[model samples]
Target: MAAPAGDNVQLTDGEERAISSYFGFDCLYDHQRKVISDTLLSKDVFLSTKTSSGKSLCYQSIPVVYQHRQLPVIVLVISPLLSIMEEQVHLLRAMGFTATVIGKDPKENNDIKTGKYSFLYTNPETVLKDDEWREVLMTEVYRKTVRLIVVDEAHTVTQWGTSSTEEVFREWFGRLGELRSLLPGIPMLAITATATNINRRKIKQKLCMMNSIDYTESPDRNNISLFVSEIPHAKPLEEVFGWLVTAAKQNSCPRTVVFCKSIGDTAKVYGMFVRELAGCHREIVNMYHSCTLPNIKEKIRANMNDIDGSLQILICTNAAGMGVDFKGVQSVVNYGPPQELDTLIQQLGRAGRDGSQSLHILFYKNNK
Candidate 1:
C-alpha cells in the first residue's frame, strides 16, 4: 500500500504546481502549507482552523498530488451532513476530479470495490451501520487503494456530533475511531473549524490519534462583526426579531439566518415567522432541521445559493451548521447560545462566507 506521505514537509514543486493547477488557487497560504505539510509527516493530523479557511483543500491536496502523478488511490471523506457530502462531491466534480457519496445516489457498492473513484464521501451512519460500506472497507481492494480517512468537521468528535442521538446527526463522529482498528496504518486527517485545547485533545483521543500532529489557527472571521444581547425572557416572538420582522414584512429581509439549539425551538421560531409573514413565508423564509426531508433541504440549500431565490431568512437547527453553502448571508441570529462554544462558533461562521461584512447576533435570556 502506498500510504499518504510521511516525513516530507513542504510539498514538492511539482506537487505544489499540480495542486495549484487542480484547485485553481495561485498557491497555498502559509497556514495551509503548514497543515498539509504536517499531515504529510505525521501519523495523523487534527487541523483546527476557522471556517472557510480552505481546510478541505488540505485533505483534497493529498489525492490531487497522488492522482497528478498517475497514482491510483482513493480518499475517503467521512462527513456528518448528507448535504455537505453532496456539496463536496459537486465541488470536486466541478474541479474536474471524480468524487461520489456512498448510499445517496446511483452509486453501487461494487463501484467502491472496483476503485472507480478518486474520492468517496460518506457519513458515520454509513460507516458504522451500513453493511455494504463496512464490508467494503474490509475488502482487499480497499486495504490496498485507500490512502487516507478524513473527518471533515473534526471538532464534532469532541462535541460528540450534536449532543446526542436525539439532538443531531453527528453522534457517529465520536465513535469514528473504531474504524481505525479496521483500517490500520492508513494515515488519517481530522479537520475542524474550531476546537479549544481541551476539545482538540478529546478529539484526537477519541479518534485514536493520540500520536497525531496538531496544527492550530485563530478561528476568527474578521469580516463578520459579533454582537450579543440578553433579550427579555418573557418577550413575545415578534420582539426577538423586531425590525428584522419589518424587513420580512416588506420582502426585503437581507439574507438572514436564525439558528436554534433544538428542533422544537427551530419549529417554533419558523412558525412565528410564518405567522407574521404568512403570505411571504414561501418567498422570504424557510425551515431546515434534521427532520426536514432531503429534497426540501436540497431546495433550501439551492435557495440560499441563489441571491434572488426568494427564501432569504433561514430558520434552522444545528443541521445547517456543518457545511451547507449558504453564501452571501448578511446576518445570523442565535435564538440562544448553544451548549458547546464550538457549535456556536460554527453556527456564527456560517455568515459572511463570501468575505462580505456580516453580523452574528446572539439573543439570550440566561447564562449558558
Candidate 2:
C-alpha cells in the first residue's frame, strides 16, 4: 500500500509509507490527509465529520508519523467511553504499535514514566484527578515528547460537560479548559461524529481553541431511510413489540438494534422478545445497558459484529450505542424520541455503516 502521488507534502516519506502500510490504503481521504497535514504543521483542528468517516485516522496518524521519525513522541487521547478507549488500544496493539489504556495498574505508571508507550488512552476524570498520572504528564519526558492531544466525542464537552443536571460530568469534563494552560503549544484535535453550529462553537470555547481549524460535513446518511410514527398511548409497548418482530423476521433486514430510553425499558423489551419470538428470533435477541456486566457487554459487542452469529437483535439504552461500531446493523428502532436531535443522529449513524441500504424507525406516543 503506497501513498498516492501528490499527497500532502507535510508528511515525510517515512510517515507516508507508515500510514499507507498501517491502514492498507493507497491514499487517505481528502479530509484525512488535510487533518494530518495541518496537525503536523502544529495547528489546532476540530473535525465534525459523519460516523465511519475515518475521523480516528486524522489523529491516529500523528503518533505513527512521529514514530517514523524515530522520536519518542506520545499522543494522548481523551475518550469518554471505556469501551471505545479499550477498542482503540487493542487495534493499535494489533497493528504492532505500543498503546495502553490508563488504569490503576502500577505497570501503566512505569510504562508512562519510562516513555515506553507511543499512545495513551484515558478519560478526562482519570487525567484530571489521578495524582500519579498527572505527575507522569508533568515529567520532562512527557513534556518533551508528547506531540498531540485528541478529544474524541468532543460534542460531550457541551452535551454532558455542562449539563445542569449531571453534576458528575460537569465536575470532570469542566477541567478540559485547564488543558490549554497546562500544555500551551501542543496541537489539540477535537473530533465528533455529530455537532450543530452551536455545539461547534461551544466545544471550541470550552476546550479553549479559539484559533482551531474547523472541518464539517453534513450528518445525513443517504442510505438510511427514516420513518416516524405515533403509537396510541395505551398500546405503545404492543406496537413496538410488533414492529420489532416484523423487522427481524424480514429477510432483507436481518440485523437490528432497538434503542430505549432506560435500562428498565430495555429489559422489558428484551424479555418480551424472548417470550414472544419463540424460535430463531428469540435466540438472537439480547439486552444491553450500563448495568450489563463488562464481560457480557464485550461478548454482546462481539456477537453483534459477527455477521453470521445468532445474535441478530439488541435492545439497549443509549450507552450501548456510543462509539461502538457494529457494521452489520441493518435497522435501528428508536422506542421513543431521542433526548435531543444530535443523539438521534448518532444512534441512527450506527446502522448502515457498511454503506448498504438501512432503515431507521422512530416511534412516539401520540399526545392526543
Candidate 3:
C-alpha cells in the first residue's frame, strides 16, 4: 500500500494537476487538503462536517492521487442511501474514473472480482446479505487492493445501529464493527453531516477506530433563515400545506422539499399539493419515499437536481436527504418538529447548499 505523505508537505505537481483536471478546481479547501494528506499518511479520519463542506473530496482525492502515482488502490465507500451511491458513481464515471455500485449489475460485480473498478459503492445491507459480494471484497482486501474503507453517513452507526427498536438496522449496521476485524490495519474514514459530541464518540466506538484524527465544523447554515411556527394539533395538515403554498408563491416557484415523518404522510402531502397546484405548478411537484419504486425514485432524484426540469418540489420523508445532493433547493419545510436535533439539522442542511439565501420552516403543534 502507498503511504500518505507528511502533514506539512505541500501537494505535489501531479496531485495539484489531478484535482484541477478531474474536479475542475484550482485548489482544494483547507480541510480537504489536510484530511487527504493525513489519510495518505495511514491515519484513520473521523470527519464531522456540515453539508457541502467538501468532505467527499477528502476521500475521493486519495484514490485519484494513488492511481496517478501508478499505485493500484481501490476504495470501498459504505454509503447509506442508494440515491447517494448512484450519484457518486455517476459523478466519478463522468470524471473518467472506473466506479460502480454493488448489486446494480452482474457485470459490475464481475468487474470487482476481476479488479476492473477503482471505486466500489455499497450499503451495509448488501454487504451483510450477499455472500458473493462479501467474498469478492475479502479477496480484494487480502490482496491489499482495497486500501481505504469510507463510511459516508457515520452517524447512522450510532442512530440506527444502537436502536433497540429496529432489528434490521441492528442486524446490518451493527455488523459494521466487524469490518475492522475483517481487514485489520486498513485505514478507515468516517464522515457525517450532523452529529453531536456524544454521537461522535459513539460512532468511533462502534466502528472500533483507533487513534483516529477527528475533524468537525459548525452545523450552522448562515444562508438559511429559520422559522418555527406553533399550530393547533387538529387539522395541522391544512395549516402546513397553506403555509407551503403561500411560501412558494411568495418565493416565485423556487425549488422546495417538504419532509414528513412517515411515508403515508409523504403520499398524502404530495396528493394535497397536486390538488392545490392543479395546473402548471402541478407538473413541478412530486413525492419520494422508501416505498416508491427504484426507477421512479431515480427519476425523482434526477428531476430535483435538474436545473431546467419542471420538477421543482419534492414531498419526502427523511429517506430523501442524507448525503443525497440536490442543488438550488431554496426551501425546506418540515411538517412537524423532527424527533431529534440531528435529524432537523440534516434536513435543514439540504437547502442553501448553493450559498443563496434560503428558508427552513418548522411547524410545531401546541400541546394544549
Best by TM-score: 2
Residues 155-206 of candidate 1: C-alpha lDDT, one tens digit per residue: 7776755453467545677689888876767878998888988888878888
The segments of candidate 1 whose C-alpha lies over 4 angstroms from its true place after superposition are 1-10, 105-107, 161-171, 280-282, 366-368
lDDT of residue 333 for candidate 1: 93
lDDT of 3 by residue, 258-354 (tens): 8999898888888888887776667778998888899999888887777676777899999997878787898998987677688899999999898
For model 3, what is the error of residue 243's alpha carbon versus the real structure, in angstroms, after optimal superposition?
3.6
Better of 1 and 2 by TM-score: 2
**342 in model 3: Cα distance from truth in Å?**
1.4
Q: TM-score, each model?
A: 0.91, 0.93, 0.92
TM-score order, best first, reads 2, 3, 1
Q: After superposition on all CA atoms, how large is the RMSD of candidate 1?
A: 2.8
What does the lDDT come to for candidate 3? 0.80
- Residue 99 in model 3: lDDT: 93
Go through the candidates in order and give the clash count of each.
0, 0, 2
Q: Which ranges in model 3 have alpha carbons more than 4 Å from their true place?
A: 1-13, 140-142, 165-170, 247-251
How do the residues 1-368 of candidate 2 rate in per-residue lDDT, one tens digit apiece? 11112222377666777898887989788899888988777678999999899999888887678667666678889888888888888889998888988883665777767778888988877877877667777666776777788999887788777876656544667568776655557778999988999888988998988999999999999999999988787884656577567766664346889999988888888888887777766667889998989999888887876778678888999887778888588889899887778888999899999999999999888778
